[model samples]
Target: MPETNPQSRTGLAFGGDYNPEQWPEAVWSEDVRLMREAGVTMVSVGIFSWALLEPAPGVYEFGWLDRVLDLLHENGIRVDLGTPTVAPPAWFYREHPEALPVTADGTRHAFGSRGAICHSNTHYRAAAASITTRLATRYADHPALALWHVHNEYGVPVSACYCESCAAHFRRWLADAHGTVEALNEAWGTAFWGQHYTGFDQVDPPRATPTVGNPAQALDYRRFADATMRENFVAERDILHRLAPGVPVTTNFMTALSQCDSVDYWAWGREVDLVTNDHYLMTDGRRTHVNLAMAADLTRSVAGGAPWLLLEHSTSGVNWQPRNPAKAPGQMARNSLSHVARGSEGALFFQWRQSRRGAEKFHSSMLPHAGTDSRVWREVVELGSTIGALAPVAGTRTVADVAVLWDWHSWWAQNLQWRPSEDHDARERADTFYEALYDRHLTVDFAHPEGDLSAYPLVVVPALYLMTEAAADNLRRYVESGGTLLVSYFSGIVDEHDAVHEGP
Candidate 1:
């Protein structure tokens, strides 16, 4: 009902992920009624609508989607339409073998979960762009549409793609960085056991035996993969940006997932009109607010301290973890409030209504199994009402005193090669740094490697395994200029090429 903007003072946007596609048209009105009862102001529709939209490639079905959008419009709910690239239609994947993701073990994954496509596939990008373009062009002027939700949770446990296209691109990337194979060989420390590459193709991604061969090589490939995925996000969102010029676009980022470097994700955030992310803390985990605060601060930092939407969070409990944990009676409200206190613009749950089947059937929602009368639903409604009443208080900022260098390249450099210490995993190290800063209420933002370093009073560079000479100089200058810098144990241990570097 209101125009959405970074500065728009709409109270914390409170709603859960909605899927009108799951049920028949007869249930649409009932869902809308329930949503209004729950005080839902926004709806993230079509997160998995590839199958619904393009039952056949190039054939668009707007009838069902049209009804869904129009109904929500009449009900005064904003829609954040997902691009649906995470789960391309089965027909598209079945026809385009290139769309399949290549695992580190050289296995091509079959379609099962969302985010299964190889980020390096050009054909996948083209097809995905076509669908994204269609959505943007059709809904550009639709006031009901508030944001563009790019590919759902682009996690990457499938490992890096060594497909021909990716391989060629990797080689070109190497050429630009190292100039020649000999230079690459020296940089990756190929002389360790005569693992030198004669040319770019000789370099293999970290997988199977390659990870054991060289940590530096493996690290660079990890960097490559991170960049590749970020590029995919940028490529897809750029289409929407061009076609639908006014709407804010963002991918829902998972704060500490192994699938991507958050630093690289920050790079992808530059293309987004605003930053949005999902935060799910295991109810049993210690200090859940630690990472949650870091994520909120990181989101604000990515958008230049602008507010970001809390895209998706478990309404009651998460089922994906090894042991699913439900949020305690007042925990959801506390968690949502904590995010706002720490600096989130708004908080949204994963699903408004629980699923009836599929992997997520057991996941909690605002409308639980007992229908809209359940406690979960009631809490959601109450929170929604409160947010509506306190919209002005919902969008305030948390002024951060600390800045952490969250360079994905550094993450790739450390883990790409085989490191002896398993505890020093990039994600873990990044979390450790964030947790330390957060423990002191020092709001922190993850700075991209290319971001200007002059903004923060304090900068922490943790576990910089692979850093360019230029980046090192930037840090040096920052510190020399009276900026308080905290370097971790393994800082600047490797060059950009992944070769180990000694102390000064």
Candidate 2:
């Protein structure tokens, strides 16, 4: 329902995620005026408005949102309406009390941080679905809405369920997969040390402090945990699609996010229409051509080189990174162009306006403390002018002959390793895989197992330790059809269960 359609041909959408909630309602008009002056065309809204939208359970308020959307619409800016589900309201937590996540260190987290909900908790899932459905139904016809942003980032560090519901779901998942406790015992290698289970209740998540542990059991739980999170994303997206027809649904992904696999998320992505990712180029350590190029290339590749949205970057210094340093003169411009150089269809920052409080108080924005008179704002205006001048080259696909497989679930599974080799971390090996391919002059794209491999002439499968039979069969099919398949060290060692395989 946005004023402009995703022009399908070429030219990037230049803008940032705008949170008007951080500022007064009086600044709405000025925000629009400044966006037009700075060349911002799209804004992602409602990302952290969960607690604001529903302060009390079963209660909803849309007055602020209505004004926010209307203001953006009046200024000819498009809106990517984020479903307000990432951070639940205080009321939900106050009543449910089981929404907190248990960390790896055996501490149950308080409700201070965002994204601290157990995805598999029945109550959490119900609340999330209700909120998402309400969002889809209400804004499905809003003319300013362009896309549906499911949640900010799927797997945050705070929330992973270790509650009774999670334990129950884990058992159900295992039972469904292996069919019985006896088969589960075999797959988990529980026959050793008399650890065999007689019932489903005997299974507990691999405690961070393992005692006579089965490596395979821990591995399977890791897989299930990651899958459970992905299932949550899909559930919300599916609800949105059914309620809001024709609008493209998406979730902003973090590239090379080790906790949740974008490769696994691609299967969920297939259900949704488009894909976008966040690439924050913080710290001088990460300010290299190699790092920037890889980040951009990975973003493009995540959607199978379908022109990814460069979501949530900083216009200047980000306070969260260790030793936050401001982007040097021309650094912001250079970084923006780097995405274009690799394969980003559009580039957007984390914020359009500055925040006054919270952890992101000092984070960079299009408008700085000096307001629109500062150098940062000037650079933003100039970049906007440049992008506006060059809108015709938006949807141009990158020339990629190589694909590097990156899976988040598999990465999590690998971390569950009790005593891994020096490079057992699949993510590190993935970086190496990319470096090798880049050195070979092959323009590489990130390939999800569920993504189309038919396009690439060559594919590098890195650390396929938890290689599923389906994935292996897919690779075999790709190779049989003349695709150049490269499986690296630690390949074909384990199935999805982390069970050691008898090499063929």
Candidate 3:
């Protein structure tokens, strides 16, 4: 595995996403000045700059980016360079409109929004690879480069595509996983609805149907979508690893259960050089702090207890919520430090400066629209100083008293069309169980269903609708070895194929 820690001059990483392209060249100097005042150490650049970097297909524009890198390096701030593959240029979309993702109901997403991509599209993959290569080759030795942020956030806004291309891709994935169509039919229990396929070409993504579709097919599609995204990440990562050898490569993960449940972090955790997460407070009436702690703990656990980065959080409130509420006076510092206490290498926000115009203009930032004299600015500076003082805590691990089992596969299965009950929410169950542990002041570490559990004296399975034979046997061994196990209702009822287990 590659080094999990980011390359930073300061022991702890700081700062947030910086989009100098959004402002004029004159404002760049002022931005750096305030960044220094706030003790900003590093900022992620070029996350959504694909359109600006390559205005036209095969036409590269590196002049502005070169200047930005030089300016940041001169100001003593490191850079988490992004590949800018999240938002392809409008021209590229016009050329290959088929690259746009299609929803299950057959609606193709427009390119105006971010993450409107079909991971199975060849044109999109080639274009993404080309830009990633260009970035790695251009700034491989840049003095300010600290880390490589592959994409903005995968499995956000959109996760799967149900287009013809995706159908073919899913068929190939199924062929690789099951070897033959006969094996797939047995695994999917296709005999029930006469859905059995005699050949791989007959399979397709679970699209809109008159009646409920096969749960097993839906579960497999989820796995295939996740793997497809991971494949793309690995492609970009390999380019960076080859061109920019020492620098780490990562894509910010939305590990919060409420934010994104598409991608499997357990699988993604192994692909990244460093595990990082983007977490926002949900104001849906539950305890926000508990959710924050749970997200942080789960992210840390994904990294196998290694120190990870708080890639993106809010300085105050967010814009996309039902009612965006500003953080209380000291809430920013408290929210940041709480992540650090759970095992984050540092804390960074969604953006260094808030947007003046755009969908996220109202989103909170380190430097708010109120300018440097505002409370957000003051809190940003204070938090920087506090983080600098806690540099000694870097590289340390957070030990947990209990382990909570979480599986994206199981979550996907439980979320299928028809289940034991529509009221049974897997995420809510996990949250409730974790909240109980939180109330007891027991630090929790999330574990995979089949992962090693001997280290944990107490292991709790909040909800796991789909369990593999290996995972079931592993739990039995854990109890046999004297470890206490607590399982909630509606667990271990189905296998990996979503088929009900016999002799239950």
**Overall lDDT per candidate, in order of appearance:** 0.75, 0.77, 0.92
Candidate 2, which segments miss by more than 4 Å at Cα?
1-11, 210-212, 257-263, 282-288, 439-441, 448-457, 468-487
Error of model 1, residue 340, in angstroms: 1.9
lDDT string for model 1 (127-184, tens) is 8889888988887777678888888876544546766677777877778878999888
* Predicted candidate 2 versus true structure: per-residue lDDT over 312-347, tens digit per residue: 778888887668878889999888887876766667
RMSD of each: 2.9, 2.9, 2.5
Evaluation by lDDT, superior candidate among 2 and 3: 3
Best by lDDT: 3
Stretches off by above 4 angstroms in model 1 are: 1-9, 157-159, 257-263, 425-439, 448-457
Model 3 spans > 4 angstroms off = 1-9
Kindly indicate the candidate among 1 and 2 with the higher lDDT. 2
- Model 1 TM-score relative to the real fold: 0.91
Q: Worst lDDT window (10 residues) for model 2? A: 1-10
